[model samples]
Target chain A: MNRIFKQDVDNILKDMYVTSEMKSKIKEKAYSQNNKRIISFSKVAVCVAAIFAFSACVIGATSIFEKVKEKLGNTYETGILKAIPPKENTIYNNISIDTAAAMTDGNSAVAYIVIDDKETVKRIDDTAKISKLNINLVEGNNSMGYTVESVGYDKNKDTVIMKISIDGKNLENKEISLEATDIMSGLESKSYDTKGYKISDIINENATFIEADKGAYNTEEGTIEEYKMLKPDEINIPINNDKTIYISNCAIKDGKLYVQYKYKAEIPNQGSLYFRFNSGLDDYYNMPNVVRNFSVSEKGDICTDDIESKNGWCYIENIFYIDNISQSKDEFLNTTIFTEYDYYKNVVRGNWNISFKVEKLKDVFEGKCNIDINGVNITRYSLSPIGITLRGYSENENVSMYDIDPVVIINGKKIHIYGTSSSEWILDEYKNMEENIVFKYSFSNVTNISNAEKIILGDKEIIVEKN
Target chain B: MGVNIVQQEYENYEIHLDELMDKYGNSILRLCYMYLNDYNLAEDAVQDTFINVYRSMHTFRNECNEKTWITKIAINVCKSYMRKSWFKRIFTTDTLKEEGYNYNFNTNIDRENIVGEIMKLPQKYKEVILLYYYYELKIPEISQVLGIPSGTASIRLKRGRERLKETLEDWYYE
Candidate 1:
């Protein structure tokens, strides 16, 4: 480019001063990160990794986003808006409050936040699912919470406008503070203590118990061996007199039990056939692919996979992580498992039981990584062609966690870990693992383990297979 | 005791931050303004960029020049804003135009001022031309900042210069 052209582009937009207001807010956010008191152990490592991926996987959320169907009331009218200082806004990631003001009548307040775009909108929404937006109205001694009331894309303005609303309350002479400090994780989810109800209590013997021949792990990795019932039990529970839900063959691999079942619903079916919850919220065409995951400690955790309302039939595949189901046979089957959908008053109660044994796989490569992260020693490292596990222990001090994205870089290329249902790791560990945590990384088709170079574990790269 | 030390640490940070501001503050904002072609939006972006820089100060590997580091961060911030700009445009009115902000620079009329012409160029070419000439980054350095290969950076630089040359020729001769 010529000097004249260069000078011209260089002098396009004049520089502006960095206001002290932005600096103070930045300091506040930065300090919160610094002053963090407690760190929760990462429960799902794969889910955590997926968050860092380019675009978050938008499973069964074809509903895309929840809209603000509520009518804009007087609080949103231009006449009611009383100008407030710009301090009300606090920006985070991709969402920022553009216009924040109180109402003239002091009954309610509104703030408009502009989301960066759809990708950012997804991230914010997904992240907010775990950690909600930390927006609050500070009124004297009484602090009130605000909700994302309505969302619309102002096509004329080219911004995603999210209208935030505070509860209608008198603020005649209140120095109200509407501050969004940071987005916090732990958007709370409710887990219920499932009460027991027998099959006889819920349904009659007309329901069909589906069965299959000897079951192998769903896919043929050969390394990921599956357990099948030597003699499949005939299980048929009638939803009603005319139809029944059938349970068939099953397989277990990498701490998860996959039970395949099918149900035939009449187009004009009379009985209410209750289906079990599995998988995550990854649904398509109102029918989600089975990815609903539930967690159970010695206790139980269940993510409502999906409920597909088709014209005739509903097929179900329930996979439970063997690790999470740490109880004995009697304890597990006797233990009541509750799905999230049970919260909906009208939904069929899908509380179910588990009783089966799969011939488990033999360890392909049971070993340890000869390294440490910060201070913690990584012991109990093992690998099958199907999966790899890395567990660490620190007796004296807490282990400083690193992003342990387990990949076997073989022949100058990387083979990454496959999907996971649930896991406990350094980042999101329970207090027990604060001093000791186990990281489990599973792969789908890793045929051989001895064919690679070194495995990258943050700074502590360990040579797994020697050339 | 910990609180005291943190405050002291922040005090030290403030001093260092001021020095950084003196060096690259206005330049970074100017760079963003050129990229975004909007004043207020660029200001907001620069504010966020500095915040990011402050938070990630410990993470800067110092593998490249501080200017390159700041410029890289600024470009990323501007791109992110632009990424969501199309969405923002629909709701927000053109406050800049409403305020009577114009692009005219009173240069000698004999020579065509290239600001409007450069702004009108496709974004890729415009960015490369500005980075090479205005920021004075070499093609390799520009690649590092833009996260593109050096070969691609070179081609863009050449193409951008040729386009600017054609534009100038059209303005002056035609």
Candidate 2:
């Protein structure tokens, strides 16, 4: 059987083979990329080894800086992205924040910021996330909109390196500030089996029918509508650890089940809980036929004051619209409520601010094009050393702007835009059309546009020099 | 070593680009075609994989064979393409017809059914199945390629075979 299967496989893939043309294209692209950058691994060997000791199990001998670059698709092996030391690695509340490095291509900029809790008594693991982080790359009156995303966590250093990307504009000769008040870590999940319990066993006389201020999704209308949802004051169920976190209330209304979770407020806002119904089977392979819809709504606490003490504890409610609730309520009872909550792990409460200047590595190519891609207008675009950012307008929300693979051809060698880290579509209320549908596509390899050819979007090809 | 040293090593080892491509190019392309059902995406992934292999040629510690190491890179590149939202939005089953890659085999009826069933399997199972059966990689090699433990790889292979048996009625496995 195995031999037959193998033969079958070979026969199935018989037609698929790397032709001479494909081999030539692949070799040309790979070697051209190799010729652009000199491969030198010995220079950062010592520093990379020190960082690797902590994350040796995860990534072998690869530097954390390279990991950050890989995460942002800026994995160009070059000295073009220069590293600038922070003015002062600020330490507060037993935690430290420093700008590890930053670079730009005269278009957009990316900075690697390290938040370390090495001296703190709290433990930092892979689940560590810096919450309520506000990053501003300011130059005079122009403040660039940025997104701070976590690259990965180094368990050895008890630190997490975050990539703050400022897009849509040039960010050279500017100072960027990263301010965050809290670091949430150790996120975990717990499952509670609802084997023998029924719906009436939880909902009692104290249940109040209130307006769904949280907004419940109506399956029939296919829109969020005002429904009289039943809100139980107390679930009256014995939760072993009721002090830290518990399901405050749960009820069924309009064929939907609503469950509220309450977390005790800690000094650093310890626990924020969420609830989900598990299918009670193995992932993917054992997926059931029943597809349910659910929405989450959190109340009482805001993320602005990440560490400030709020007036009350945090309350998170999950509203699940059970299809054919009358018939499937029994089946739903067999499901488990998996309440995911993070422990009071390595949460440090202090504003660790860092302002750093980004140096431009190379001159960028910026141009405008009047191209239409399946009813979506492609207007302006910017090509940087790291990646390409295209700004366009789309009147139709149903039509995706990414209708075709955007191929950047340099000297006849075509490089596909592998993935996009960010794509922002802002609604233009005045023009009545979304003018700024920004798609920032990063190249996996170093892209030099000096001798570029053209960019193919959908079926239309736009000459780089003409555009 | 500096890049100039790498250039020297490339010449010293006689790792000719044409020779290396001849040895691994077809295998990697077939692996990528199975991994990513799209011919165009798989072609791009093949290029990216070779590019990565070229970039990290110096770091190829003999922990595993050259095939396993290169296969691992190819799988990672295919996964990166899979993560893109445009990958799903742009490419569909209709794409194979549109691109004229002969994605659906018109040769053998039974063989086509088996290959189609294997492709229809979830990514988690299909990956292990292809690596184990088609590539003839050992459990450890599959584990290294997928970045999972050997025991987990075995379990996935067993489960994936069981899933195939359930779906393919006339199919037999030992």
Candidate 3:
């Protein structure tokens, strides 16, 4: 090799030499005395003690549990009754709302009452009633109980008659009379609108009015109804003297509402309709079915398949699924699967499944013989007719599975038959199937099996030596 | 005879300490010097590196050669030391002063100007250049020390050299 001469190289080497010499002196000064002292007494004494304590606790508990279980019969009836306390019936009370007085207190001179009795409460809910009432409570003070401006039960029908006064003169009376069934059903359902109402008459009582403009009214009934407007804010009244029935907490949130009322006898399902008109458009529509179920307790189940778009667009984002297997109303055990779907209907992200199961060995190992495969250490061993399955997570590759070869070496001889062949074994085989395999085996002939202490299969190994 | 024995033991300690210091101390100091560009900080980093090596000497397996092992320790120490708030504040401010320190030395044809320009390169390019050219390390060795693929190290070295040439061209023309 040719000798290379570079000034920069020479400077760097010279600096390195000087630095190294200085480092040695510093090292000796910093560590020589301490290093000798540290070696004299083990530095890991505390850590070793902590590990020993933890191991002893775990081992002690395991052995104690084994002895106790052996002493006491492991039968389900005996063990469960001994372990768990008896069940008790818990009584729950409902909010009793004085329907008659609540309606009379609100200055509506002529009140349209719908009492939610026990039957009504059982069929529909308080939330539905409050939402319906809010639609009728218009923002105005009138002589006849806030002048029943516009009313709707839900998104289907509305009964609203607005008579506008311009310059202290009555101009027009626009009356919207919806079909009776739509009106009744609107009151029954969770939401309602007035677009299905038939306009019977639009009389300009004040003929000399300067302008007679028509405006549109949109209601929760999912319909847009046109109305003749004589003037804007023509229906003004004293804010303090307003006889409107104030219905607070009536807004729909998370696809459900809660309402309350009091009644002695079962009140048949009955409700009122409300509507609003502005520019031939309906603002209130059916809420989306994204939230399939609602429960009082925090522990409840949710179904993602029933998700439907409100108004044919928009979806719930950041949705989380909660599963309470013990208390879930669904038939399936408590298994929560969280998922996020994009606007294009693709599951963009989320955990696929989180579940746990317990099964008896008799049910798992049908009649198939258990086989401990050679050259592999089964972290989790299960046998079925198809093959033996091993469950383990790889340090290099995440989660994976492996199929154990039917034949395995034990005490120098290859044994093919291990587990019994039965229905239980078949079920175990199918249940343990996984998407990816983690280990592979290669057989090598050896004269003395006792001499072989360890077997390597792909990236994993098994130790045959006794401890 | 007792006095002579004590004197001989003292000599032996001195020789052993000196030999160990000569072999590893400069390498550790040079690594820190390259990163910090300050003699005192470089010496401190080397001190820390040696202390760690001495403490862990018993656990040191004969996996890689001792030089590589010590170099790895020094690099890790320098990285951690650089993370200290005081060290970062001091070094970042010092970089500005050192920016033009080499500028006056390039009087012949602006060699100092070339050095200043090299210092202005991005940290990644500067590290590659210092490791490859200054330390006389091949691309593969640089890759291993830096914990990057050899191909990536080679590419960075080539790009760094080209950038240095480009930066020097402006001074040369002037």
* Winning candidate number (TM-score): 2
Could you tell me the lDDT of residue A190 within candidate 2?
Answer: 44
lDDT of 1 by residue, A1-467 (tens): 34654455445333133434334433554446553321101211112222233122222211112111111222223222233433423344434443423331232333434333222223233323111233333433344534342234433222333444333334344444433333321122222224323212322223333332223232112132232221121244332223344443244434444444444432111112122221121100111112221111222221122233243334444444433222233333333322221111111111111111111222234555557764567875655443455667765332323224466776688875422212233444446653355544544222245456666665557666332
- Candidate closest to the true structure, highest lDDT: 2
* Accuracy of chain B in candidate 3 (TM-score): 0.63
Q: What does candidate 1 score in Cα RMSD to the true structure?
A: 29.8
lDDT per residue (tens digit) for residues B60-156 in model 1? 6647666777777788667655534221222123532222112211121112356556655555666777787777788877876765557767776
Error of 2 at A242 (Å): 11
DockQ of 3: 0.06
Top of the candidates by DockQ: 2
Fnat, one value per model: 0.15, 0.24, 0.14
Docking class of 2: incorrect
**Candidate 3, residues A1-467: lDDT per residue as tens digits?**
10121254344234234433243345455545733311100110111211222222211112212312221223222222121111211111211111110111010111122211222223222122221111111123111111111111111111111111001001112111111111111121212223221111111122221121222222112232322112211122111112111111111122222111111111112211122111122121111111111111123221122222222211111111111011122211122211111011111111111111111111112111222332222454332211223433222221112111234344555433211111111223344433112222111110122223333332344544332
Q: How does candidate 3 fare on TM-score?
A: 0.26
The candidates' DockQ values read: 0.06, 0.11, 0.06
- Give the range of the ten consecutive residues with the poorest summed lDDT in model 3 chain A: A99-108
Location of the lowest summed lDDT over 10 successive residues in candidate 2 chain B:
B99-108
Locate the minimum summed-lDDT window of 10 residues in model 2 chain A.
Answer: A282-291
For every candidate, how close is chain A to the native chain A in TM-score? 0.24, 0.58, 0.14
Stretches of candidate 3 off by over 4 Å are A1-6, A12-25, A33-467, B1-17, B93-118, B167-174
